[model samples]
Target: MTAALDAIDRAIVVATQDGLPLVDRPYHEVARQVGISPDEVMNRMDRLLHEGAIRRIGVVPNHYALGYRFNGMTVWDVADEHIAEAGKRVGDLDFVSHCYHRPRHLPDWPYSLFAMIHAKEKAQADSLAERIACVLGDLSRGHLVLFSSRILKKTGLRL
Candidate 1:
């Protein structure tokens, strides 16, 4: 990640950190800005991904802007020993945006598995939460859900 980048690489990073142009040929446009060919842009991107310079390159839509109003964070008090396997199963759920195990704070917070569920309504999110609960089965001691009343725009990090 250090010696792998040059001026042109930095230029491409700057051009795309926010987003690729919403055009027929966004890579071409980025190449033009970076003083390179479209194929060069693609090649560099491929290299970056192959070398693990970047985690992922993809579109991150604003679910709230797309009418997904009910944003819920579902938590489950899963056994620490079984958390890894349970998180994997929950992450595979279609309605689950992402699921991972996190450190839990005792005396108040006891949930270890966390997943974000999105839907157009509260009821829909609740239903999705139930599905996740069923998947967890008797593995989890309990579960809780909290929904956001307002949209929280997620602007992917750029630098």
Candidate 2:
């Protein structure tokens, strides 16, 4: 069920949706914009997290700017019984940025587990895929690394 957000909660969401201000005290800045006390801002944010109104409050870094140019989405055909454990193991790899399960399209597409790997070079990306393969081992029936040729604009959800 979706949490019912009050006026202050909505204001807080709008104030920080694009990203909190790059200040030493970001919550304080958010409070200032939302016309509330910093403590209340933090408390509401905490409550929002617990209530599932907000999924996460964290930085979304630009990998390209950070010299991680090679972006590959590695798809794995993992056994149904082992998907949960396989996802956890794949996500734990230091080089993997994101890992999750995707519904497979039989015959054409058998991949279910998808992991995003970033690297500074093409070879590094390949090496990262190898590491993921090592982790999956017998669980992975087959896998493919789809390298991104261009970047799509990214934006946070608006309130």
Candidate 3:
């Protein structure tokens, strides 16, 4: 399990919940907000990753603003035993921004693999989904594409 975050650590998370600054010294900016040194911010982030408090620290560009108008959360129904392998293959695709295995919901929802695809339009997103299907091959029993009409709430992990 991840370690409990101290006050400073929690402050860091709160300050960065929206995102890090766009300036060259984003960490320094975060440090400035958290009332700590830049090195301390780096050390805390390193510890967060090391202790499983955070998986990674990186940039998240505004996809829609960048003309990536279509984003699809593609779900797949795959054999539970083979989902791990299939998900890895899906995750490796250049078009797949993110992919992972998830628990199934039985009757109404049976997807075991979820992959996020970004494209400029719906056709392109669907094409990428087709490519994913080709990659999953016989392992996938079925699939569905869920679209997002607008941004709801976007945030990384919180303490």
Candidate 1 lDDT for residue 62: 86
The global C-alpha lDDT for each of the candidates, from Candidate 1 onward, is 0.87, 0.92, 0.89
Model 3 CA deviation exceeding 4 Å by range = 1-7, 156-159
Query: Per-residue alpha-carbon lDDT of model 2 for 79-99, expressed as tens digits?
Result: 889999999999998878899
TM-score of each: 0.92, 0.94, 0.83
What TM-score does candidate 1 get on C-alpha atoms? 0.92
Greater TM-score among 1 and 3 belongs to 1
What's the CA error at residue 123 for candidate 3, in Å? 1.8
Error of 3 at 70 (Å): 1.6
Residue pair clashes in candidate 2: none
For all predictions, the C-alpha RMSD in Å is 1.6, 1.4, 2.4
Which segments of candidate 1 are over 4 A away from where they belong? none
Give the candidate order by descending TM-score.
Answer: 2, 1, 3
Expressed as tens digits, the lDDT of each residue in 49-153 for candidate 3 is 799777677767778889998888999999989988998899999888899888998899999899999899889999999999999999999999998789766
Top TM-score model: 2
